[model samples]
Target: TNDPLVVFTPSGKRGRFAVGTPILTAARQLGVDLDSVCGGRGICSKCQITPSYGEFSKHGVTVQGGALSEWNSVEQRYQDKRGLKEGRRLGCQAAVQGDVVIDVPPESQVHKQVVRKRAEARDIVLDPSTRLYYVEVAEPDMHDPSGDLERLRDALKDQWEIENVTADLHILQTMQPILRKGAWKVTVAVHLGDGENRPRIMNIWPGYYEGTVYGLAVDLGSTTIAAHLCDLQTGEVLASSGVMNPQIRFGEDLMSRVSYSMMNAKGADEMTRAVREGMCGLFTQIAVEAGIDKELIVDAVFVCNPVMHHLLLGIDPFELGQAPFALATNNALRLRADDLALNIHPSARIYMLPCIAGHVGADAAAVALSEAPDKSDDLVLVVDVGTNAEILLGNRDKVLACSSPTGPAFEGAQISSGQRAAPGAIERVEIDPVSKAPRFKVIGSDLWSDEEGFDEVIATSGVTGICGSGIIEMVAEMRMHGIVDAPGLIGSPEQTGSDRCFLDGRTYSYRVYDGAAAGGPLITITNRDIREIQMAKAALYSGARLLMDKFGVDKVDRVVLAGAFGAHISTKHAMVLGMIPDAPLDRVTSAGNAAGTGARIALLNTAARGEIEATVRAIHKIETAIEPRFQEHFVNASAIPNAVEPFPILNS
Candidate 1:
């Protein structure tokens, strides 16, 4: 009765399916695998598509109107700079009324995530205070009277270049048995430097062989949890897996969880358990795939943003969300599975990377570590863009960090047409302003049947929404073409007669109703959508500028963008919109989830845990709330993109 939902996917395949289905549902029906981060709740914005023709229907639930507008700040800029245009719907939010086709852009973290790309350099630098290694004497038999203790010291001296070895209470108790079992071959594991010269023997494997050990680095993000199984010998990531951060039930943003924690202690504990369970499950699955026993996972590293860090440690996060924004702990902790209720080898060491401040948590530390800021002399700026954007700047000499509440704008929380990045969602849009024509990409095409159309695409995963990235692109595009102005006014008086940016007398009320344009029935960008983007970009830009001001650098030698946005962001577009500072396009690099990378580093080399902590200490955090400069920066950063003005690159 209707044209099928035509869809194209990342694999370069195309398919069509019948109506009345979500994208993910259709994906599974056709034996396709599309990862949905929001679990089909229409939140993650991971599944996105471009629909050619289809009816979009919803239950008509009343969403708060004032929260978003047809234009205010964000939209005008989006239209002018990014070249985004109408019908750039989040895959989860839009439904198919008829035949529609779409494309999935390369930037979306859908289908898969960007892995931690690490350099294979083992010129390891560990904190002398925390990393410890001791060689114990092998028990000399009747033929050899050197004694077990003496043999161990000799091995330690020969290998570790240490004159003396220290043993802890637990190590002392088992030394004799260990010597007997291993024929006097013992390796003591301790923080690199032993103040007492006593090293704890983590394990007494038979024989005197030195093999690479494995560790896991984990980034416990509020929306996503990533674990990198790494090799300790040469510092390499072996096998890694990432899943949704399981804490979404409490609320989407960190503030919700913090408020919940303050209200109910039991709620806090439950939240902690949820994340721990998720992390443990991922750990077990990854270890099995890596051909390693559960016990082989000895050391683990973890770094989470403030609230997530608190939830993972069972610490109260209430203060972090409110005035005086306090943190429960800032020092690095050496813990065991029982401490955090994590399921791992019972005796394995757990290192939680230190947080710099209440808002700027360990995620920043992970970013700094992954980029190795101390090794460089050129200025560098690190921006971790998420619900909360934490920024940092410096070279090898000095580094300054700050946190900005970017809201959930980038993640598409408050926008009207926003949906999780998923199938049936219009992931990428290339619009020609003069012709008012558009080309789009969707998530799933390889799995659709020719008979069906938008229904098959929408059914893929029951996709119901759009996310932050899509919103940014859309807002930028709309602003650039004069659909919206610098102040977010819907339509200009000059283009009054036939202008269709708004309908129904509302600034953003244009409705596609039934048969509409190429992508199907849809109202394009709204005034409120523009404002949401303005706030988000402002926060990111403000944070970057503030850090630059602190360090007195004009243009950073390198700009490292971190977190979800980092995986795929156009440096040129980002600079044009002033979302990030202007620099050589190549100088702006993406550090795919540095928090996860730091976690992997901790997992692979437990001793490095101390090093990471010290690095966090060196970092200085600028509180945007208290710092008047950030407020001023934010006010200016909030302006929508103007057609005539050049995007400013802040200098001292």
Candidate 2:
């Protein structure tokens, strides 16, 4: 039994194989992750592997030059056409000649891990719903009297061990021609199925499909619809894009949109059509950025607010706008692309995360999935700030959730000279405590307003307006430098000792920038703008405090500011404005778009879909609207950093 010893690196899986055995066969026998779509036929080059040869004292073996057989004709042919990397060999063609160590590159492994950018976040493991399989089928014969599809199924069952597979009518229509075209051998993209679904064919190719499929992880916000087009097999984000929600013309906030539906007969339908069109456009842009065909996208996962969820599904949101705030359904949905008129693969699967409640929607559930407060030992609070803020407070034993209607003030709506986060929008600000002068940075430029070449930096997108994050820091800096009072009012020049503060309409306004000479609009923070921010932050704080009350806690170990806006807001500025609860500044972290991350998690791992569903079921929902304590907290939170609740960390 003088067999060659084969060892696979990164996994440390070792086994003894016959000398002439194919590396792929040896890898399969030892449970190594070597991929192959065309079996051992070498038609697909997915089974590429690199072998090492040297003295190996640690592994207790001495490698030689003839460890693996020389590349065969199939490898040479593949290298000539597609060009394999130097020193790489096709595992399906290379035979084990002696003791050898093989390394499987990340791209070659089917379940490779996709590293996340966040230090504390979990990596996404590739385990998509749809996968490709190459199989050979017997051609149909009149004498045998067997259908082509039956023979294909038999081939799948015999070759791949897949059972009871079904195909859509579209596949059936083209199956005859494709089967004959491939000379009875074809590759089929199969949706492995979930819940009550049966394994079915999504698409078919003549032979082995050289290209991989794609999936979409979408975060459908009330203001914007964002999507991440990802490689299904690799879990890599090929492109990310977003578009402003077209429903903004109808209403800026969720409640207004709901009211519009109630007021107009066809308002709901019109809004639905607008949103759908917007989503389709976003998909097209994302696909183009990734340089892939839209039809290659076969799976999608969506996380959205309750109202958006209902509207997207063509359901009237009247119940969501009233008392009790009942949702039509809160279950996770699995559907087809055509059911929603999506322009992706016709048979693509769409999975929506489960909703937490009428107010706290699937977006909150997605946040929970990504942040996972329920699994934490330390009591953590997660706040997803937007038009409406979704707040969660919990630990290992219990968790409570609530929603606060923060409105569109945070997104720069309903404010004089305010705009969304865009180029030329002021995003960072700092004021001198003595001079009472301000220096700020706009979204598109890295230079500060007082720095050299600042004008040229903003020349293209010329100082437009203040955005949500900018307004937060501006007001916070105003309060810090005594330009604005704790009562949320801008002071007069005499009272504040700042000449930039000028009286306007019986109140005062702080002039951040005066661009009149340059033919640009004069940008100022009016008394009303502070009031809008106060209302938005108060609602956000009250929601968090309401959950704290329900959880019977006055403090939390950590605070995760989640959302695109949250990622940019300074934690110190946020605390000065009383946007969140008291916590160490270091403990207060930003989880950029946690709901979108959760959607990506669900898209890559099918098991995560079930995990989030179970988590959503266990979460306790608190209705902030009905709770009297919410009013009390709202009043207290209206002041800068709370009137009653002391932020000891911020104070220190």
Candidate 3:
């Protein structure tokens, strides 16, 4: 006679088990992701499952009665003390009596789905690299002559089915004391190795370790360094922080930094030290914010552009500065935290995503991973706007990537009366088409300049200056109101029919706010400021157009802006300036900090590392410097809203 048939729901995994077999045992045999913290002793209550009765057609299983054994003493005691939900049974204690169907709830699954910011985006499942396992080792015996470490390894294999486990020298030295302290029972944090690594023990606790380990996902950008501290078990973000890159003292951009390294003898080493010091400071700040011991951070992942990648790894970036732009290496890296002088766990492992090209580095690969353009059916264009822009255009069939040198103007560096996106910076703007009068909103206060109670709100963080987003809107509004001409020239006050426009030297300036009497700088938009914005936006549009030419497509179905500045910039203004190709306004949306999200994804799911590595290989890289049409596109894009391209959607 055949034994009872067991079928698990949601995964559709089926198996045949003996009459006395436990549900938890069957789940483990079938490789289901049911969680258990207390080694199935009914203490943690993490393996609760609900069984369904009277299933007729699916899996050919039917249950009339007595499909599961009645609740035992341990379960009864647990229910009496803690109270289990109705229709719930502990997988550990419930024995199969007949053919049965089990439904594992989302809460019981070890890898639960974490929803992304956008509803349409794919959800990330929690499958962390490191995990905790509890084991009971045999006591040392003089007759057996087996070492304590050998017994522990044997226990792990016998109880948890883990084999070929290794440990560092430090773990070896401390193993004896910890084994005796826990009385032969200990909980070990193991890094479940990937293709290139073997399973190794990261840390050990005396007995039944209750605390969870942590991982750091860092997005190392040229302008700033950002980090997120996350819990490995639950996939929760504990704290988020950022600090300036600090290498800015050497140079403002990548090429400038490379030049500084060439001009100065010790410039490369000085920059390497500065960036590492800044990173350590950021790690400490975040660890303090999360109120956790730094030693608990067991894993970390970093994503960055090529120059920053080279600098972080202590490689000189001279190769990336010259023609052909060859990188030192383009493969993913795995190392220990101590190797990089990071003060996390002494043996904490770090993974860096692969770089796509010499200029299109791992940051672009991170954006592709987060957006998953290769998986999309519709043609999509993803633009990560920053000091240097990374553009990707692709679909399910193929994908293309390129990098453009847009400069630091977009970050409010070169523009006059500009500042970073801090409190009191003007972030929103509007201008009346006929009168050319302007009203705007700063970052701290939500009220418009003309609204009541606006003065009170401004008393604290007075209007300081305009930011990147503010500059985009300021230029776009000027074009829309006929204040700035198509050639990026501000008309005279009489010609523009507005007293706000006045001749400053030979050219004209548009005054948005005149508060000099109130001890505030006279905030105005100069002709040179218009020229800087024109150059920045033109470079951005030129790169996108170059990718379009290679793809043999006239227009993309959708556009996704993926950066901090992209998240806040006005889509209407971007279209007016022709910063991006013309498309339906509704189809253009923002994926806030896509590169950072990708880093978090890789941190939480180890399998994503291989997936992005494969995707990077398949992607085709286009060099914008070599493309002849790039210069042509730049010239046309220099004019406000393009000199040749037509925006039918915006005109309508």
Q: Tell me the whole-model lDDT of each prediction, alpha carbons only.
A: 0.62, 0.89, 0.90
Clashes of each: 127, 0, 0
- Sorted by TM-score (best first), the order is 3, 2, 1
List where candidate 1 sits over 4 angstroms from the true fold: 1-198, 208-212, 444-465, 492-500, 509-523, 552-558, 602-615, 642-652
- Candidate 1's TM-score: 0.69
Q: Against the hidden true structure, what lDDT does model 2 obtain?
A: 0.89
Per-residue lDDT of model 2, residues 1-652, tens digit only: 7788888877888888999899999989988988878887888888999888775632565555548887789888888888989889999999999888898988788777887868335667777888888999897787899988899889888877789899899999989999888888899988889978888888888977778899999999988899999888778889999999999999878899999999999999999999999999999999888899999899999999999999999999999999989999999999988999999999899999999999999999989988889889999999999888999999989889998989888888888988989899999999988999989999888999999998796668789899998999999999998898888889899989999999899899999998887778899999999999999999999999888888888888999999988898999999999999888999999999899999999999998899889888999999988899999999999988778888888989
Q: What does candidate 3 score on TM?
A: 0.95
Between 1 and 3, whose TM-score is larger? 3
lDDT by residue (1-652, candidate 1, tens digit) is: 3435444444433345555455555554554444333334443344444444334322321112111112323324434555344644344444444444444554332222223344311233321222223344544668866655567667767655556555444545656776677555444543333222234445444434344356777878888888877655435567878888788888888888877777785888889888989988898888887887766565777788878888888776767778788888888767766687666656566777788898888878877777777657788787888888888887778788888888887776677767666665544444447743344444454332222465555455333444555555555555555555666665643452224444534564322122243344453555776777888888888888888888886567878888767665556556645688767777788877776766655554445566667777877777778778877877777776423224444221
Give the Cα RMSD of candidate 1: 24.3
Error at 84, model 2, angstroms: 3.6
Query: How many backbone clashes can be found in candidate 2?
Result: 0
Give one digit per residue, the lDDT tens place, for model 3 in 1-652. Answer: 4888888887888888999788999999998878886677776688899987765445555545438888999889889989899999999889888888888998888897755666224578888999888888899888889988788889878888788888888899888889889888888989988777888888888877879999999999998999999999888899999999999999888889999889988889999888999999999999999999998999999999999999998899999999899999999899888888888988899999999999899999999999999999999999999888999999999999999988888788888889999988888999988889889999988899889987775677888899999999999999999999999999988889999999999999999987675567789999999999999999999999999999998799999999998899999999999999999999999999999999999999898999999999999999999999999999999999999988898899
Error of 1 at 356 (Å): 1.2
Compute each candidate's TM-score over C-alphas.
Answer: 0.69, 0.93, 0.95
